[model samples]
Target: MNQEPTAQEPILRIDGLSKSFGPVRAVDNVSLDIQRNEFFALLGPSGCGKTTLLRMLAGFETPGSGRILLDGTDIAPLSPEKRPLNLMFQSYALFPHMTIRKNLSYGLEMERLAKTEINHRVDEIMAVTDLTPFAERKPEQLSGGQKQRVALARSLIKRPKVLLLDEPLGALDKKLRERMQLELKRLQHEVGITFIIVTHDQEEALVMADRMAILKDGRLLQCGAPEEIYEHPADRFVANFIGVMNFISGVVTPNGSFEADGLSVPMPGAAAGPATLAIRPESIAVSMNGGGIAGSLVDAAYHGLDRVLHVKIAACETPLQVRVPAHTSADLGIGSPIHLGIDPDRCRLFPD
Candidate 1:
């Protein structure tokens, strides 16, 4: 089970934050509370203001109107260097010519710390990030993951109250990126620092963040734990963005039944009106034949562990995706007639 953040006093608070570039509003009246030692993510697609919000938090971008409070004190007026925070950019900005130790020590040295103290801090952070093995290597000598670790170590050696990561793993290959996702989570827990990462990848956010806020078109859409957001989306945008959802447009009848294109399903507690029902692919079951909704398999994608089938039904315009264990149906093929079993409890109803 994923651990939830406690109700401790929030370490960072964004209040009515908005940013604009001439006629374009990048971040519009966004607000959030991030708890101490929490691994929080700002998630959204491109042009959704996730990166802009992160920049504001990093003191790299000034908000047109708002207050950013760090530990109860507004830090909006502080410069990037003055804020007790560090931002690790997507491009591991380690000096190409500098050794890993030099890269890690450069920031501390810039502050004019004693040589012994800088060395001690660098050594400590390198150990924490497991970069000691490549301490003397240049940036070119290290792998993408190692370079990322070096960048993270450089940002973290200062013991900042908060660390901001802007798509820190986007440069790595698929396998390495996935490995770093878990590694980043483990590092966050080991250090007990508040980490705020901005990423458009839903799976990465879900895997690493303790809590996450979804943004869209410069507005805050939904904020919650991964399971909460995935299972209980607030609206259509969130349902569509977070994962694959099949929406069946229908109207709730007086008998608490939903009626669509020649199909009706019991939908208790739904107000009598037009609404959309959202169901995940995994929540639906498919079989060769049954007393359920009739559909024909349009396509089947054979993944290693599971098979995803696109079933075309007359009730809806688009095909509904059904995921099943790969071992269960070896003969399921395209154009095969099938029946769909939808779990009512797993369906989310929203007013149209």
Candidate 2:
């Protein structure tokens, strides 16, 4: 996580940004500030308008209203080429006939820079992205990872103020995708350029972003650090979207307590009506013998280092997913009596 410190002033700002296509509103009054040299993520599921927002930033799509400010200057009217921004597409989009060097040099060549300067920029970016060794290879001759590096190198050669990526690692396998998450972060740090990536993968944002904005149905839900949003979701949709959440339904009494599932917890400022207590799997304490809410282990799921146990409670309609260490779940089996203890402070209550 070590990298350059982000400046206090925002390098780019979206003010009341909105985009629409006929009857459909793609982005609705979204606003965010992205700091220089920081890795920011725009994350959401399909049709959530994350891609539309990114397109607005990249100048590919014009905003219906609001303004886009890059270093306090409005760039909404600027065309994509005129703006000092670059976008890397998901497909890599390399010319099959071009060598890795030419692919990286194409943008600079178009600018009609001196040959010496162009080669210098290409060489520096190649080394930064580790594409120097494959400089002479054509795009079709390279592996997925190498092609990706070449595409990235091509963009970085321009030394853009901001780089927009649309699911850059979507084509890679899971293992390679995971590895490239850190690699992208490293490149962002080394290049000292602000990177705004649009993706639907929750884990990708959590693993790569310094700060992230989550969207749904063209609405901006929350923006914060990965852990901040994960620990303190804005609402039920965000809690469920960001990660696995166990919601125990209940009603808030005037005394400020939510009672349900044979469990009662404090819910301050909550109105008297139906509510939900959301807790992550790791937050719930599990035990075989303790004065806690009792449930039966109905099913189990095995992950590498963790096991997800599905616990059934009579008061709850569906089974709760509880995460535990692999070792702790080894001796447990289906139909085993289990007890869950959740601290009142660890739960998030959303009043409906």
For each candidate, the alpha-carbon lDDT, in order, equals 0.91, 0.90
Instruction: After the best TM-score superposition of candidate 1, give how far the Cα of residue 83 lies from its true spot, in angstroms.
Output: 0.6
Q: Which ten residues in a row have the lowest lDDT in candidate 2?
A: 1-10
Per-residue CA lDDT of model 2 for 1-352, tens digit only, reads 7654556779999999999999999999999999888899999999999988988888899999999999889999999888898999889899888888888889998899999999898888888888888989899998998888887888888999999998999999999999999999998998899999999999999999999999998989999999999999999999999989998888999988888858877777778888888999988889766678889999999998999999998668889989989888799979989998888888998887
lDDT of 2: 0.90
- Steric collisions counted per model: 0, 0
Candidate 1: misplaced stretches above 4 Å? Answer: 1-7, 287-289
> Which candidate achieves the best lDDT against the true structure?
1
What are the per-residue Cα lDDT tens digits for candidate 1 across 1-352? 4654445779999999999989999999999999999999999999999999999998999999999999989999999999999999989889998999999998898789999999989989988888989999999998888889999999999888999999999999999999999999999999989999999999899999999999999999999999999999999999999988999998998888888876677998789999998999999987565768888999989999999989998889999998999998788778988998887889998988
| TM-score quality measure for candidate 1 | 0.95
Task: Indicate the residue-level lDDT of 278 in model 2.
Answer: 94
Where does candidate 2 stray beyond 4 Å? 1-6
TM-score of each: 0.95, 0.95
